[model samples]
Target: MTAKHAFHLALLVVFMMVAPARAEDLRAVMEADNARWLAAYNANTPAAFPAMYAKDAVLLPPGSQPVNGNEAIGKFWEARLKPGDKKDHTFEIVSIHQDGKYAYQVARWTVVVVKDAGERTRFSGNTVRIFERQPDGGWLTKVHIFNADK
Candidate 1:
């Protein structure tokens, strides 16, 4: 092939390789996802939270059984939001990383709860969320893993 044609083809390849990952733009999407999590907590609703996860998502806590699937996760949060169960809660996002079709977020979360006998308990944990891109151009959690930082 001619030298001009070869140079043009090379340039096209370089542009295509760099186009998909606009590094600065991913932060916004990550921020929005982090905000969504906090909103779900404030509303005490599991629907939106679990919807952020894939259908076969898996949640691994620091010291507990794995919570599998959207339904079970929804049920767990619904119960946690019941009266005399939990009160004030907040989540602080620490960092987010985006690469191709996957991303991870780290955050610290705190919550106050009341027991059946009216005793109060306060706890906090560091959480890491792993997300995968969906076919519809949305992101969903493929794995939710966290540990108690205290």
Candidate 2:
């Protein structure tokens, strides 16, 4: 092969090698999802939040019924947002695992809520979220399990 041909072939090979890193890299997907989740909660727009979830999504929230599907999950958040008030909130991702079209991630979170009687309630939890790659090249959450840490 000519030098020009060899150089072109080498560049093609390098591009192919880097395709997966850009296409399905788990870390980037997880980080983006984490940011979106934080934004959703801060916006207090639960109705619009479930659109990020897949059609068959399920949520296992601590101390409550298991919420299934986008509608149910959206309802849960809407109700929670209506509560007295919340503060001292924070969240961070712990880990992420990608397997083909599916992925799972863990996030640590904490929140403080104040009631009418001037009472303060503190809560901490870990959230495990499962995601699936959609046909349209987007990641949608499939399952979300929240467990209290204290």
Candidate 3:
């Protein structure tokens, strides 16, 4: 083989080895994002919740049409999260994959909510989320879709 060809092949091998390590690092970042999301939901502050999404993000909730943009997303969450309600959220990541500036996660989530009379409702679902790496070197959700496990 030509020396130049061997050099190129070595470079390719190095890139392939480094790629998986980078993906692992991204997985850690996504896990942190999931934790932040749960915290935001528990806090019951709609404003804080939408900050996890990109400015032009979209949310696809079951039995509903798509909601676009952070402002609209915040309003949607606010309507559902009343001031006096208590909510708990748990997320278990099934898988996370990344390609270039984009990554996606499949996770199972459970949420329990209690109302004024201690009436509790529980919902569990599987979710798929698409993330984009922002210019500021942070990750934000670009698309989020989830459905109930019922």
Candidate 3 structure quality by residue, lDDT tens digits, 1-150 = 999999999999999999899878977898899988887788887888678889899999999999999889988888887888899889999999988899999999999999989999999999999999999999999999999987
User: Which candidate achieves the best lDDT against the true structure?
Assistant: 3
* Residues 1-150, model 1: lDDT tens digits: 999999999999998877656544566776787778767776667777778888898988777799999777777677657754556677677877787899887888887776678788888998888889999999888888877756
Model 2 / residue 121 / CA error / Å = 4.3
Model 2 TM: 0.75
Error of 3 at 70 (Å): 0.9
lDDT of each: 0.78, 0.81, 0.91
The segments of candidate 2 whose C-alpha lies over 4 angstroms from its true place after superposition are 1-24, 83-88, 114-121
Estimate the lDDT of model 1: 0.78
lDDT (Cα, tens digit) per residue for candidate 2, span 1-150:
999999999999999988777555778878887778776776666777789888789989888888888888888888888444544566787877777889888888887766667788888989899999999888999999988875
- Descending-TM-score candidate ranking: 3, 2, 1
lDDT of 3: 0.91
Summing lDDT over every window of 10 consecutive residues in candidate 3, give the lowest-scoring window: 40-49
lDDT of 1 at 50: 73
Q: Which regions of candidate 3 deviate over 4 angstroms?
A: 1-20
Rank by lDDT, highest first. Answer: 3, 2, 1
